[model samples]
Target: MDDLYDFQESFSYKLVKSETTSVIPSSVRKFQINFNFSFELDVSEWILSEDDESQLVSQSHHPVVDCLVSMSSAQFSSFEESQKYMEEKLTTTSSGLSRLKSSNRRELVDYALREAGKYTAGGGAHRVLNLHFDVLLEHEYIYLRDISNYDESTRHMVPAEDSSIDHALKTVEYSLDIPEMNCSVCLESLSGDDYYREELLSMPCAHIFHGDCIKKWLRTSHYCPLCRFEIPID
Candidate 1:
């Protein structure tokens, strides 16, 4: 009875023969029961797939990270080219400036020699030096006053009576040999025109003049033609 109650309460069962083996012993065998359990795990599904929507979302949030950066490279290249160009220009300008300085000094020396030679040959070095002293001072060359101090005897070398007469004779001979001087008004070389022969004014200072030029000059002030020696206007 107890075994019947136990079999009714549970489905699992085991069959065994009694120890006294009242029934056939070999006919009964033991049977064991077990409960089987299983669980389904879904691991194949992806959390974030590689699709167009996912790529678009990533690009929209951080666009600069994916963009190409080349502006700095282009700017650097331009700067290098500009630096080379400036260096080339500087080299050319420096050489040109050096040549210009050399040529200017040469021209100044030549000009000084020509003017000085004229005064020395004309026997008017003192007067010529006085006139051009200011020019020398402006150019920052040696001053004429300094030179005069070195040659104290030069102050007494003015033309004397006999020397003046000799100079006049030599000048007359030279004038006869030379072609008639140019007319200052017309700037044309004169060949003793009738207008110049009668009325032309020859300044006591060294310059020859046309009658008209002298009349115009006398209207302003009484002075010698070349040097500004005061004279009677009349």
Candidate 2:
């Protein structure tokens, strides 16, 4: 009986050792990680999961142990790298958008004019002109008379200058003199009754004005009549 008991104890000890020896160390166990990525306009997220089942079970015995052991150093490093890359990309994209907005003022004006034009077509000539005028005025507080001079025939003529900046400044001045039509630029009424007649000119950005005004403007600068957006003259 003593010998039998000794043999049983020896067998149990050997079995335990064998089991322990078969298990790979936590560091040696090959683990595969899968990353799930989510893409959005404002933010992004990632989920990490293990790919191997046998390795995962071998790493921990209890359910709680499984959770603790599942996380690997390599996986952590990968996640951190991915997060940094995403942050940098987002910052670059935001900066690009801001620059685009600042540099594309003329483009914005042109787009607005094109959209407004669609509604002006087939409308009364006066109505069409008024619509265009209103659209321009909405964006810029300019006087109506600077761009539209009245002739002896009471016909409206465009200014002869191509400089949109000058036109804007003149409009502001005119607005100031007229009290009844209190111009915001001048904060006064337009006092002049004199009117001139001339043909209007159109810029590549789709802004329209008197030919002379645009020409003179172009001599000094090349930009939209309403916005100081850069134009490629060459």
Candidate 3:
């Protein structure tokens, strides 16, 4: 195991609760697994530009952590086939977690497959995982140290200007559909009648929030309420 940060692993799986049939014209069920890889890095010396006159110096930069770092999926008609495919995937080029030891890696794959097997075979597919990881990166000549509690807040966030917030709201005005999720800002539903829909706004990071709530939030913090994704600011 890599000794950069303490590795903690846990997973959750559920049947994709939809009556909608598979897109493929087959009887086999498909499973989609998404991996969430988290890393702690020491970027204090990681400067984007050396010159103060450079336009890059004025732009905001934040490490992407909440998005889908990688995705892997396969269809299996039978449990045995799925287990076999996962076992063989460990040694294949398409395996996502190839950096770990064989013994530990196999254990994870087996555990995931076993959980997946519990569901009915002909059900409407399954979704598994939101796995977390810690990685260490070292260059031959450059050595980077690890920092504790590394995040955008560690460097401080600059409050976004009115122009940027206005632009974000305008984009949402043209959107045809608002997501079913709750707004992280007001902790309320973003979907409902047309009145509620008009009150919804989405940031560039795609996190939706109530228009008034997010407008107030961006005045003090430029980070997304849910993911800490940074937005352009003064």
Candidate 4:
């Protein structure tokens, strides 16, 4: 029993509505449905979980906390101002906290989004890198960290510009025998009647792909999808 708590723990609280006596009528009382957040940190391995997702926001030079503290809407002043600035904002925005309901994880997330919108509207939005998701699946919980800002994309796009465009064009025009080789991207042969007339592209490394397919691929990738000859981002 003692060892089990080292890894996991659970709690239960009975939200009382009103005191009932043996002579008085009693109504079933339950806890209000409201979303709140909790977190843990290593004080080490700080960069492990954050290294990849940080780029999702397109920030280059600053640490995660640095970006959040800079947000004018977020009332955070320093790392130490945890409760006063954040709690005050959340409580003030909660106009109908007693009515909110979250019976499951998805409903909980929806409640959170509504609360966040209320908080942001009330001018108490704060930027921080510490908040993340706690997803429950199959009676287990998984932790996932995320940025507080809702506007940023969580996916990466292809780098802009291409250094070997001229060489690539020549490779497609002079070397391709469309009927004999498949476009490496869609994995469909140019010989098919469906693509007999569609434009094709080639990389300097000699890989071929449908013109439209390669165009979209290049937006998110700078290398030949097959050979990985790096296309320059200029």
Best by TM-score: 3
Top of the candidates by lDDT: 3
**Candidate 2 structure, TM-score to reference:** 0.18
Per-residue CA lDDT of candidate 4, range 121-167, in tens?
Answer: 54332322122333221111122344343332322223536544544
lDDT per residue as tens, model 3, 115-172? 4444434454444433433332211111122333334543333578788778765445
Name the weakest run of 10 consecutive residues (lDDT summed) in model 2: 7-16
lDDT of 2 by residue, 1-234 (tens): 001111000000000110112234555454222111111111111111232111110010111000001222243335445344333332233111111223232343334334433433434222112111111111211112221232323211122233444344321233332323311111112233457434444455544444454565555445443344444433
Report every candidate's CA lDDT. 0.27, 0.28, 0.45, 0.36
Candidate 1 per-residue C-alpha lDDT over 1-234 given as tens digits, one digit per residue, 9 for 90 to 100: 001011011111111111111232242232111111111111110112223111111000101101011112122234444334323332232111111233433343334333334434544313212112111101111112222133323321122243332232212222553243543333333345435542445555656555555555444334333344444321
Number of the candidate with higher TM-score, 2 or 3: 3
Stretches off by above 4 angstroms in model 4 are: 1-157, 160-167, 171-177, 194-196
**TM-scores for all predictions:** 0.22, 0.18, 0.32, 0.30
**What does the lDDT read for residue 26 in candidate 2?**
55
Better of 2 and 3 by lDDT: 3
Which is superior by lDDT, 1 or 4?
A: 4
lDDT of 4 at 146: 40
Write down the RMSD of candidate 3 (Cα, Å): 14.3
Please give the ranking of all candidate structures by lDDT, highest first, separated by commas.
3, 4, 2, 1
Which of the predicted structures, 2 or 4, would earn the higher TM-score when compared with the native?
Answer: 4
